[model samples]
Target: MRTLRRRMGLLVVPVLGLGLVGCCGSGERGSDASAAAAGFERAISTGDTAAVCAALAPESLSEVEESGKAECADAIPESRLPVGGSVRTVDVYGRQARVVLASDTLFLSQFTDGWKVVAAGCRLRAGHPYQCAVKGG
Candidate 1:
C-alpha cells in the first residue's frame, strides 16, 4: 500500500532516526520486538490500561505512575500516548529496538520477561534522544 510505503519512508529519513541500519541479530528477535510493539498499540487502542502498563518496561511504567501520581494501570491511559497504527519497520540491536509506526515511534528493551516499550509517542528533537510522551528514556 502507498500509505505503508510512505510510513516506511518515514522510518528511513534521518529526521525520524529509525533507519534499519547496523542491525546484527536474528529475524526472530526482530519479529518478537515488532510483536511487542503491536501488542502495546493494540492495548492502547482498546483502552486496556492494565495491558498497556504491562507492556511497558519496568522503569517506564514507574515513570508513568510517578508522572500521573497514580498506579500504572490508572496512569497509562491518562498519559494519552499515541497508539494503534500499522508497524512500518522494526530495528533491533542487542536487547534494544525501535519500532516505527504510522503514528508514532516506540523504543523498546528486551527484559527477562520479554520485549517492553521503554518510550512511546516519540518525536526526534535534533540534538537529543527522541522526546517521548511516555518515557523512562
Candidate 2:
C-alpha cells in the first residue's frame, strides 16, 4: 500500500513537456481527440481495465506497467486517476492533442489505429510542463 501510494505521487509530479496552446473546436481533429479522451476517462472511471488499457498509448501503458511492477489491468486501478466530467475544451496541434474536461486534463496523439491517450490526470503548473498521473517516460 505504501509503495502504491508513493508511485501515485511520482505519477502526479512527473513533468511532461508538450508545448500546446490553443482553444477547442478546431474541426474533425478536435472531435476525434475529444472522443478518444472521453473514452479513456470513461474507461478509467468505470474500472474497465481492458478499455482503459486499450485506450492508452503504447508508451503510457508501458510506463504504468513498469511503475507499478504489475500488468496494466492491476496497475491502472491503483493509480487513483481522477474521474473527468464532460469535455470542456480540446486543443489539437498536428497529431498531438489536449482535452480538458470539467475536472481533468488529458493529452493524446493520433496513431494509425486512432487517437490514444498519452497522458491523463494532468495538472498545469505555471512556467512548467504538465504534471500527470499517467504518462510516458
Candidate 3:
C-alpha cells in the first residue's frame, strides 16, 4: 500500500505541475489577456458604448440585454460595474483567462476575433467562485 501510494503521489505531482503551468500560462497569452481587460476599463471610463459592448463576450451581452430589456451598449452602462483599475495579474488556462485588476477581476474567454470579457467587476468570496457584477446567466 505504501508503494502504491508513493507511485500515485509521483503521478499526481507532474499532473498538478502541468495544471499550474497552464494556469500561469506564458507572457504572450497573459499580455493579451491583460490588454483586453485594460481595454474594457478604458472603454467604460471613456463612455464609449460601442467599445464597451464589443469587449464583452456574446453570452454576457445576451444576459445584460435580456435582463435590462435594452441593447448591449445601453444595458451595460447601467449595470453598475466597478471601476477596474490597473491590471495586476493575468492568468490563462487553455482558452480561458482571468485578469485581476486593482479594483476588480475579469474573466475572459478567447474568441475567434480576440479575447472578450466573460465576466467583470468581480470580487472574491470565501470558499466560492468570484461574484461578478457583469456575467452571463
Q: Which candidate comes out best when scored by lDDT? A: 2
Q: State residue 12's C-alpha deviation in candidate 2, in Å.
A: 12
The alpha-carbon deviation from the true structure for residue 72 of candidate 3, after best TM-score superposition, in angstroms, is 1.1
Q: Is candidate 1 or candidate 2 better by lDDT?
A: 2
Please give the lDDT score at residue 111 for candidate 1.
95
lDDT of 3 by residue, 37-76 (tens): 8999999888888998999999888888987899987888
Estimate every model's Cα lDDT from 0 to 1. Answer: 0.76, 0.78, 0.74
TM-score, cand. 1: 0.81
Q: Write the per-residue lDDT of candidate 2 for residues 19-137, one digit (tens) a residue.
A: 33443447898999988988888887788998999999998999899999999998998778899988988877677777889999887879999999888888877754467888876
Q: Looking at candidate 1, what is the lDDT of residue 45?
A: 89
TM-score of each: 0.81, 0.82, 0.81
Off by over 4 Å in 1: 1-20, 24-26, 126-128
State the lDDT of candidate 1 residue by residue for 1-137, as single tens digits.
01111232132224343444667334899999999999999988888888999999887888888988999998777777876498988877677788889989888889999999888888766754456677772
Clashes counted in candidate 3 amount to: 0
